[model samples]
Target: MNIENKIDELISLINYHNEKYYNQDAPEISDAEYDNLMKELIKLEEENPNLKRVDSPSNRVGGKALDKFDQIVHKIPMLSLSNAYSGQDLKDFDKRVRDMAGSDVEYVVEFKIDGLSVGITYNDGEFEKGATRGNGVVGEDISQNLMTVKSIPLRIKEDNEIVVRGEVYISKENFQKINEQQENLGLALYANPRNLAAGSLRQLDPKLTAKRPLDIFVFNLEYGQNLKFESHSESLEFLSDLGFSVSPSYKVFKSIDDVIEHIEYWTENRGNLDFEIDGMVIKVNNLKQRETMGYTAKSPRWAIAYKFPAEKKKTKILDIIVEVGRTGTITPTAVLEPVRLAGTSVSRATLHNEDYIREKDIRINDTVLVQKAGDIIPQVIEVVKEERNGEEIGFNMPNNCPVCFEPTVRLEGEAAVKCINMSCPAQIRRGIIHFVSRDAMNIDGLGESIITLLLNEKIIEDVSDLYSIKKEDVINLERMGDKSANNLIKSIKKSKENDLWRLINGLGIKFVGVKGAKILAKNFKDIDEIMNASEEELVNLEEFGGTMANSVVEFFKEDKNINVIEKLKKASVNTKTIEDKNSNVPKIFEGMKIVLTGTLPTLKRNDAKEMIEARGAKATSSVSKSTTFVLAGEEAGSKLTKANELGIKVVDEATFIELSSLSSKEEVESKLLL
Candidate 1:
């Protein structure tokens, strides 16, 4: 066969295997065989770029990086479903649906996948566009990113225009693997699979999105040109036949009671599944009935989501221990008997502080009810006092640092007991770890274990000491080879040029977080200016309070901290705030408080925030009456609603961009008036 024919054959073969392995979870060929086929296709495509098919399986690896996602207005709004928390709520929903429509209503039940919702459009059997379900009415186009998902078929068998909706998710196993990789790399681990999947899909680089293990399950046929389906179940079957992955557990039920029973069973056994599902959705099966029932303002009247409550498990607290953080704050943790909760084994939970423990009356050997807060951090919710025996021992906060034997002091009106000794080993180790963290100096190859080794070997005494280390100091250490040591030294040297905000955050000053550091950096030109600033001067800055100002003053007052700053300066570290080159841009948004919501059409949220802040606007997280305007995009949620309710001004990405380009505040006001 010719090269063209060979390429087509290879594409067909790889797509078939992808469907089998990813969609059906059944592989007919070995991974190596599949890989070899893909390699041959990639080689052929590289040799003959003009002959590469649009639906080539090679696209599953990634495409060109996107400058920004374009806005796609969905033909039909992707209405959210109202939630039902109890069996009675489900019954009420059924009664309401039957009362509105007919008594012969049947329901299709499927898992309410805890993932990002997206709409994919296909034209003449080939994938055209894919977009996030932003605000239901509009979404950001993510076609390139969606093409990277192996389960999402690039081409279908049928030859008609179709729009299908699905949930994109990362499997629990993949989530664990990704977190492990993050831990090894000394990066912040993702809080949950849902967030990771959402973030992955929204990545500016399709290659980065492709690196994540993403999967999708199509649930709805939103639009089909000249096609019809009798019921929701029928459409799902059609989707599955079209080589799309559909939920395997969906079932049609004639009785609402049966649906409730099924939901209950899944709620109890959701842990068995590899993917996360926060609830179950019950939709009116018949298409004609759904049309008649229609939708509410924000949700469908023909369907309701039965939300599963946060899973709580009973476990015994074996002991309580306190850990000193980088800032020297003491945090008490409960060592609990290992119990499975939210698909992970829980062996410990945060007791928060002394007040929390005293109020909860938690004790060692006491049976406690533990649950994952937002399916991430494990925390003790309630003490099972009825199950606790009299033999349980109450615990108290330590009076001294466990690691350094230094006296711990609790400040007035503060819950945290802190180790004030600046040289505490625990504090030093944690501080070094923070100094090399991603948001700080971002020195790669310096994970916790490596830092611990360096500290033990006496090669580094503090954060400043890291700058003076030689290649010989690390090359002979465990897990450190010549190349690794060289890379480490280069990374350490490169970090000296980071912006002033990073250095301030790395200092681990009390009450000065990332945002606070940015605020400080914006106000002060260098560390010396900040050190000389009075508490009143700090308090006068935006978002700074008396407590934060006092913390900054007290931190700089210490002779040890001044010595460290001198050392950092002596090593040629950049301490001055780097001024933006675009200084000509007018501060049209000066003194205006803006809240951003949803996905912007042509800008990342952070980029938009930084742009606004640079132009003299404060980007707040929530909408309030005091908000000057809300920059809303597709899928703007509660913030948009609240903005509307409070009569706060709202602007789109276009308007915000226009305002940003205005020469003066008067021009901005004139534009808004127009």
Candidate 2:
């Protein structure tokens, strides 16, 4: 066959199969076959650049960075929920419903996704826009990124304008893979799937987002044609019929008992699924009843989320080990008989305090009951005293640090032990890992194995050594090649440009997180200034606690740390620049954390985030107490409840725009004044 014909055949074949596999979930060709064909096409395209179409099969791999995030105003106000944390909470909600609406209320119970909320708009059966739930009223548009999700339909069935709400999440497998990549790259791994999803979705590069296996489940119809479903369950079915991946674990409950039972069932049995569920969402199933119920200033009167008790399981403690953390915390890890829990096998649990160990009587070779502390981290709930043999030994934190072999000590009212060793191998390893983490420097291809290889090979020791690596040196290593080396070196070089917060984070200083790092970096321009800062100086910083201040003080006091910083400077790693911090006028969210959910009536999603950032505040992608406000538009899901529970201020779209606008107007005035 002629080369021209071969190229056309390859492109046509790949396109056909991509649609079949990604869109249809029916692969006419195996992944290997698909990969081989794609490889051939890529090679061909590389050889003949003119033949490469802008919308070529290879372009589907993803594209360059987004110029800006568009702002979207949700059509509906995604309202918050009054949560029922316990059985009584659920019962109380039921009682309130019965008292108000009087006993005949129907509710639809759904698994509350521990994920990011997104809004997708379909106009005339074509995908129009997708946005993050930015301060509920406004969101950042991520339509291009959202389109890459295989489960999300590029086109919906209905021709009229249709808006759908969904929870965009990374599956457990994808989360793990992403984490592993982060670990390999020498970047900090996200604590959980929710974070991974948020981080992945917000990535400036759509190609990176596309590579992540993100899935969205359409659960609500915010607007548009023929979505006249009377109940939440019915709406879900209608959405499913429209080629949307609707979460199927919903149950229609007449009485509150059924709601309670459904929550119990999932709490005990969510391990079977590929995703994670933090709690159950119960919404009034009747459309008329829901419309009648309406919404409060913050939450919807028609809907309530019944959170599951955090997952916990009983297992035998096989051993107890005191490991030294990078920051010199001597933490106690309970090596337990492996038990399946919370969608993964748990073999260890963290015993936060010696007092905790004493109170719970955590011991080596003892039976113990552990609980997932917050549907995320595992902790020992209590000792299984009845099953424990007399031979079971109680654990005491060590005298010497596990890594540097220095003396370890615990302070009054403090649960953890500290090792003052800055050069401790464990700390070094963890610090290097953290330095390369996504939230930190985000150095890809720097995982533990390669770090170990570098360490073993004596190619480099500290993070600064990363800069010293030659491509030939990297390619010479086993499994490392010309491409891998080039990519890794490029990634490492790219990391130097990540903002001050990332550098602070990458430093692996105790008690200095992304938020704290930013504050410190802002206060003290460079590493030397931070190191010179006294404990009281650090303590005086806004929101800094004495314990945290002391930790920071101690971290800097170490000799090895000073050396590392010097080496870092020598390596030319940029650390002092506060990225995008040049707003002449400040917005309410300038440096304020914000969470967006539901549908916005106006504005594109990215535009909303950019607006928030244009003023002085940092636009965070998730909801937490640190978050100053939640801009809720229409159909805000779980995050609405999370904001309420965390006591973060919740605002409607109007309020959001008004606050954001105030900042802009102020900025205009400030610019004039300047």
Worst 10 residues of 1 by lDDT: 580-589
Give model 1 RMSD, 1 decimal. 4.2
Candidate 1 clashing pairs?
A: 134-635, 135-635
Q: Report every candidate's CA lDDT.
A: 0.89, 0.76
Query: What's each prediction's TM-score?
Result: 0.83, 0.67
RMSD of each: 4.2, 7.8
Best by lDDT: 1
Model 1 Cα lDDT, one tens digit per residue, 1-674: 99999999998898789879866999999989988998999999999999987789889888789888887888888766677999999999999999988899889999988889999999989999999987667788899999999889888998889999999999999998998998899678777788899999999899999999999989999999999889999999999999899986899999999998999899889988999998999999999999999876667789888989999888899999999998889999999999977755689999999999999999999999999987789999999899866889989888889999989999999998999899899998999899899878889999999999999999988889989999989999987999999999999999999999999999988889889898899899999999999999999998899999999999999998999999999999999998865466678888889999987777878789988887888899988878988888766867876776687877778678878888888888787676
Give per-candidate clash totals.
2, 65
